[model samples]
Every structure is written in C-alpha cells, then in structure tokens.
Target: MIEQRDVVIIGGGHNGLTAAAYLAQAGLDVQVLERLDVLGGAAISAEAFAGVDARLSRYSYLVSLLPQRIIDDLGLSIELAPRRYSSYTPVPGGDTGLLVDNHDPMATAESFGALDAEDDVVAWAQFYEGTQHLARALFPTVTDPLLTRSEARAAVGDDRLWDALIEQPVGRTIADTFSNDLVRGVVYTDALIGTFAPNDDATLLANRCFLYHVIGGGTGDWNVPVGGMGAVSGELERAARLAGATLTTGAEVVALTTEKTVRWVDATGVEHETSAEHVLVNCSPHELARLLAAGDAGPASTADGAAAPPAEGAQVKVNLLLSRLPRLRDERVDPAAAFGGTFHINETFSQLQRAYDEAAAGQVPGVIPAEIYCHSLTDPSILGPELRASGAHTLTVFALHVPDRLLTEANNEAMRATLQRAVLDSLNSVLAEPIESLLLTDANGQPCVETKTTRDLEHVLRLPGGSIFHGDLAWPWAEDDEPLDTPARRWGVDTGMPGVLLCGSGARRGGAVSGIAGHNAAMAVLESR
Candidate 1:
C-alpha cells in the first residue's frame, strides 16, 4: 500500500524533527522515517558501560548554536547549563597551568601573569570582543533568508575585523593577534574542531569552522544541556509528536525519486512506498547522492549533478566512565575546576601545527592534541544518584588530527588502539597519576573506556568516512553573482532535484547541533506552497 503525505522527511535526526514539527504545526501532513529504533543521530545519550548508571552523551555533546527562538517556537523543555570555568591548559611538564575563569577575572588574569603573559590578558579580551561583534551581526540571520556575500560583509560593518576573521587564513590571524603560544593554541583549537586543515591552509577551511564556533547565538558560549544530549533530542521528539507528525522508526530509506516517491524497508523486511508533495532530506550530501544513484529514475550524478566526493573527518571520540576525576599535576588549579571545563592536553600552538603536518605525512602524531570535559560536573542528572554519590563521572575525549585516511579497513582496530594509547599518553602527561587509575570496571570486569574510530562510526551510522559535520562546512551566505532562482537555492537547501531539498549538515550554514538547515528547508516548502 502506498501512503501519501504533504512532506516526507528522510532520516529523523534532530534537524528532520525540527522540520517535521514546523511543517506539521502549519497544518501540513508530515511523515518522518528513521533507520534506527531511536532518533537524535549524533546527539544521543546512552549508558555506554555495563553496570554503569551514568548516561553519557555518546557522540556530539554541548549546546551552542541551537537558537533560543527554535526552543520557544517548538515549545521544547530543554535547559542549557553554563560552566563557570572556560578552560584549563596545563603547561606541559610544568607545575602550573593557565585557567580561564569566567566569573573570576582577577584569577584568570593572575593565571596569565604566572606564565609571564600579562600582555595577553588585554589581547585576549580584545580578541573575543571582535568575535562577539561578529556574533551579534551574523547569528540572528542564520534562520532568516540567505544573505549575499556583500550583504554579509556590509552587515559585519568593519573591514579590518572582517578581513581578520573572514578574508585571510585563520592561522595568520591567530599568529598576528596573540603573543603567547599557549593562548594562540587555545584560540586556534576552535578552527580545527571537526576540520582537518593546517593553520596556513590556503583553502581557508579553518576560517569557516571558526566562524560557526564563535558566531553561535551571538554569545559564543557552549553550554551543557541539563540531562545530557538525549534530553535535548527527546524534547524535539515530543515536539514533533505533539505537532501531529507521524514518525516511523526502524524504516531504512533505500530509494528516492524525482517524483517525490520514497521507498523504504521496514524492520521486518517489509518494503513500503510513500508519495509526498515535497521530500526534505536530513542526511549528508554524499549520502543523498548515493540514494539518488540507488533509485531507478534518479540521476547518476551528485544531488545537484555536480561531483561531491565523500567527506573525510579528522577526529577520534573516546568515552570513559571514571570512579572520580583524575588529579592534575598543576597544584595551583583544583581538579574540579580543571575538569569542569575544557581540558587541553598537549595542544600547544606549535604542537597543533606539527600534528597536522605529521598526520598529513601518513603518520598519527606522536603527541595527539586532545580535549576533555566532565559533563557530570555541570549536569549531575546524567548520572544516577548512587553514582553521583560515589563520585563517579564521565570523561569524553575528542582527539584531533586523526583523519579518516589514517585508518584502513584491515587495520582499523589496530589503529584505534594506537590512537587510544596516544590520546591517554597525552592526557597522562598533565596528570599527577595515570588516567587508567580512575577507570571504573564494567559488569564484565572490563575497564569502562570505549574508543570509536572513523570506521566504527561508518558501520554504526552511515556517516561516510565518519565525517561528523556530514561534509565540509559551508559558508552561511550566498556568493555574489550566485543565482537564487528557486526556493531551495534561496534557502540554501538545494538538492538539484526539483521537489527535494537538503535539511542536514550539507545545507549551507548547517553544522553542529543547530537546526538552521531544517528550519530553512521547511520555510522553503512553506514558501513554495
């Protein structure tokens, strides 16, 4: 039997849910299909370790780009908690580290003074002031209609600030603006979060990544959701359901047609067909191309009939359940304070650049630059009362410069182990004791540390090459002289097909947990109607 809907959304990730909620609320019949039994995509929470009651955010964590407008519009009940300490970076092999305290300016300044970087105290403030300016000018426009490059630049209003952040390579800006190597590394990490580019990358891919990180919500603060990432997605699920959007999980979409007919197989191996007036895709651009190629009536080329190679991601995610936070070698800073915010390990300015060089040369860096944060410290609700009382916590370590090209199918496991050891070795360098000492045993008497490689993510989620942002991040605005002839093009959701639109990271301005792509796609459909 063939069912019909006004709009059929593929892949019920958070973005798909956002579109479903909006369209359904507007009295359109919407249906969302998801392959997994549960939704949320990368934004999910699970009890990763057996016998561990702590629910760790398994993949993508933190909330920064999610607009408060979306939350209010969808009637979501999500709470974002703030961490007072911005970050703590130990001076490798030294007895002291730099800590940025959000609430205590005097302390943060003193930490810089300890490093003889008293000059950076003013430079750091001035640098962020510029980012805040960009954030204010650009953030409110994310969900609105597309802005041309000239329009965006004029909106920015300052040529010097625009040139520093937008026109030139981000590495040059970091090198010229900040004096201290540690401070420069801290600033540069934002550019390399999910991107695999060097500081002097001529392509300026790092600049685009840095733009999204800083312009989020006009405030540039990454907050922790109260009950882990699942709570955030759960609210979206509730919103979609309440809006009368039909959600069918465990349905794998295998084919899509130019006629807006979607084909999928249900959990029991049942093939079902559905027709829609509009088809909104919530998958990667690369995955969308693969689906079109699978369809009999679909084109053999990319979504827009342009070639789009599979995107390669460059990070390794390792989740750990520890009995307690590990002690730090820096006696000046409290362990609670250091772990509460981002914990930088072996990620100095020169170290990060050299790591990229080594990774590009076909070798994992000897010292992997990694960042760790303790979610339980900010939102204890993710942990069971017993575990909270027992002083147990969750540590999520995201290591950089481990590109997907580094691992092959035959050597994925071996390489994952190697990367894991390198990550821990970097962490252990700043710790008073080995991080393994705090590891909690699971029910099977195994240490509760799980490392996810690129290949593992490809097998689990159809993230081609395990690219978390789906592919390279796109600039938020339209280039000058670009055509906006259709609703898809104007809204930045074009999929080349006439009635299909992209609603995921592939969409312009799409990345992170932000639902801008979904919102834009829905608007495009609504406008067409």
Candidate 2:
C-alpha cells in the first residue's frame, strides 16, 4: 500500500521536527520517518550507568545556536538558564587562573589584569562588538533568503571586520587582537570547537566555526537547558506533534526518487512506500547523496572535485556522574565557580597547536586539551531528588583535537579507555583530587564515567565519520552562481532536485541546534507555493 503526504521528512532530528512543525502549522500534511526508535538524535539524555538516577546529556552538551524566535514561534516550554561564569581556565602549578565572570566586568578585568592584559579588557569588548555587529546583520537572514558573498560583505559594513572574519585567516586576526596566550586560547577555542584546524593555519574553516559559535542570539552565551539537551529536541518533537504532524520512529528510509517516493522498512520488517509533494532531508549531504544514488536519482553535483567537504571529526566526549564536585587547586575560586562554566585544561593557544599537530600525526596528544562543564551546578532538574540531595553532579568533558582515525574497530574499546584516562589525567592536573575519587558507582560496581569515541558516534548516531557539524560547516553565503533567484535555491533548502530539500546541518547556516535550516526549508516550500 502507498501512503501520500504533503511532505515527507527523512530523519526526525530536531531540525526535521522543526521543519515538520512549520509545514504542519502551515496546513501541510507532514510525516517524519526516523530510523531509531527514539528521536532527538545526538541531542538526547540517557542514564548511561545502570541504576544511576542521573539523566546525563550523552552528546551535544550545550546550547547556543537555538534562537529565541523559534521558541516564541513554536510556543515551546523550554527554559535556558544562563551560565554565571563564561569560562575558567586553571594554569597548571600556578597560584591562579583566568576567569571570565558573566555578571561582573571588574572581576573579568581583574582576571585579565593578572596577565598584564588590562588593555585586553577594552580590546575584548571591542572584538565582541565587531562580532555582535556581524551577528545582527547575518543571523536574521539565515531563515530568510540567502545572500551573495558580496552582498553579505556589504551587509557587514566593515571592511576590516570582513577582511579578518571572511577574507584573512582567523589565526592572523587572533594574533593581531590579543597579546596573552591564555586569553588568545579562550577566544580561539571557539574557532576549534568541533573543527580540527590548527592555530597557525590560514584556513577559513576555523573562522566559520568561530562565527557560528559566537553568533548565538547575538550574545554568544551557551545557556544551559533546564532538563538537559534532550529538552531542546523534546520541545521540538512536542511542537511538531501538536501541529498535526505524523512522527514515525523505527522506520528507516532506504531510498528516494525524484518523484518524492520514499521506501523504508518498518521495525517489524514490513516494507512501506510513501510519496509526497516534497521530501525534506534531515541528514548530512553525503548521506542524502547516498540515498539518492540508491534510487532513480542521479549523482550529486560536485564543486572543484568535492561533493562534500572531507568529513573528519575530532573530539572525544566523556559523560560522568560524580559523587561530588572535585576540589579545585586554585584556593581563591570555589569548586562551584570553577566548574560552573567551561573549565579549560591544557588548552593554551600553543598547546592547542601541539595537540592538533600530534593528532594530525596519528597520535593523541600527551597532555590533551579538554573542557568540562558540570550540568547539575547550573540546573539540577535533570537529576532525581535522591541524587541531588546526595550532592551528585554530572560532568561532560569535550576533548579537543583527538582525530577519529586514531580510533578503529579493533582498538575502539582500548582507545576509549586510553582517551578517558588521558582526559581525567588532564583534569586531575588542575584539580586537587583525582576525578575518579568522586565518581558514583553504578549497580554493577562500575564507575559512573562513560566515554564515547568517534567510532561510537558513527555507529550509534549515523554521523558519517562522526562529524558533529555533519561536515565542515559552510560559510553562510552562496558559493557559486547556482541561481539564487528563487527562495529554495537562495536559502540552500533546495537540493537542485525536483522535490528534495535539505533541512539538516548540511544546509547553509546550519550547525549546532540552530533551526535555521529547517525553518528555511519550510519557508522555501511555503514561498514556492
């Protein structure tokens, strides 16, 4: 039997749900098919340790990309609490470290004053002011019509800002702006959040990642979700379902045709065929191309011998439910204040370069650069009352520059163990006590810490090469003369196919939890009508 709908969404990630909600609200019949039984994809929370009351956000830790407009438009019940501290980086064996207090500028200035960077306080504000200007100009247009590179540059209205952000290497921009190595690393960390680019490299990839990270709501504060990362996708799922959209999980879409015919197998091994007026894809572009190749659809168009950017994901994620917060080595800052925000370890500008170089040479760095955030400190709603009363906290560590190639099927387990130990050792280097001492034991007598490598992300989340951004994030403007006269083509929602639209991170202006791709895809469908 054949089912027909106005729109068929291939994956049920938050972006897919965002598209479904918008289209269904527009009175279009929309159906979302997800291969997994559960939704949210990487933005999910689970009890990793058996018999633990902690609901840890397994992947995709923080939130910065989701816009306020999406919440107001969708009427979502989600609440994002701002982090009191922006970041705290401890200097190993030093008396003090750098701390950027969100509420107090004097404290921030005082922190910088220690580095003899009192001038950086003013420079920091000026630097972010420039990014704020760029955000104001560009973020609003993400869901609207796409702009040409020249048009975007004109919109920016600053030649120097354009030259640094768009034209020149971000490394050059950073070196020119900041004098202190620690402060430089703090700013540069945004550039290499998911990217594997080295600090001295002259690539725009780091610039693009940096732009998206700080462009969040124009403030760039990565607010903590009340319930976890799951809350973001959960709200999106609720919005889509409430808008009269049909959501079907455990239905793997295997093939697609130019006519919008989708073939999938159900959980019960039953095959189903469905046709739609439009098909919105919520996976990577490479995956989309593979699906198209499986059917009557032709080969994906290439540019300069690249169908999609080389997909190599770096970073190792470790989730831990701690019995208590680890004591800080720095006596001035309390444990709560240190881990309340992003706690950086061994991530100096030069250290980041060393880690990248070592990872590029097929070995994890000796002293890995990683950041940790304790979720329970900001929002304890994700934990049970029993766990909360016991002072149990959740920590998510993001280790940078660990290449996926270092992890293979044969050594996946051993590599995860090694990386976990490395991450802990790096953290313990700054902490007064080893993090292992504070780990809560599960029912099976296993430590609460669970680590996920690139291999896990590929096998579990279906992220090709485990790339968090789906692929190298694209600059927010059109690259070629591929006809931006129409809304679909202009916004990069249209896949140059008859009825296919991209609504995932592969789309332009897409990365993190931003709903711009999904919103733009729906707008393309709506405007074309």
Which model scores highest in TM-score? 1
Model 2: residue 439 alpha-carbon error in angstroms: 0.4
* Candidate 1 Cα errors over 4 Å, as ranges: 297-307
lDDT of each structure? 0.89, 0.85
In candidate 2, where is summed lDDT lowest over 10 consecutive residues? 301-310
User: Can you list the residue pairs that collide in candidate 2?
Assistant: none
- Among these predictions, the greatest lDDT belongs to 1
After superposition, candidate 2 runs with Cα above 4 Å error: 301-310, 479-482
Error of 1 at 246 (Å): 0.8
What is the alpha-carbon lDDT of model 2 when measured against the actual structure? Answer: 0.85
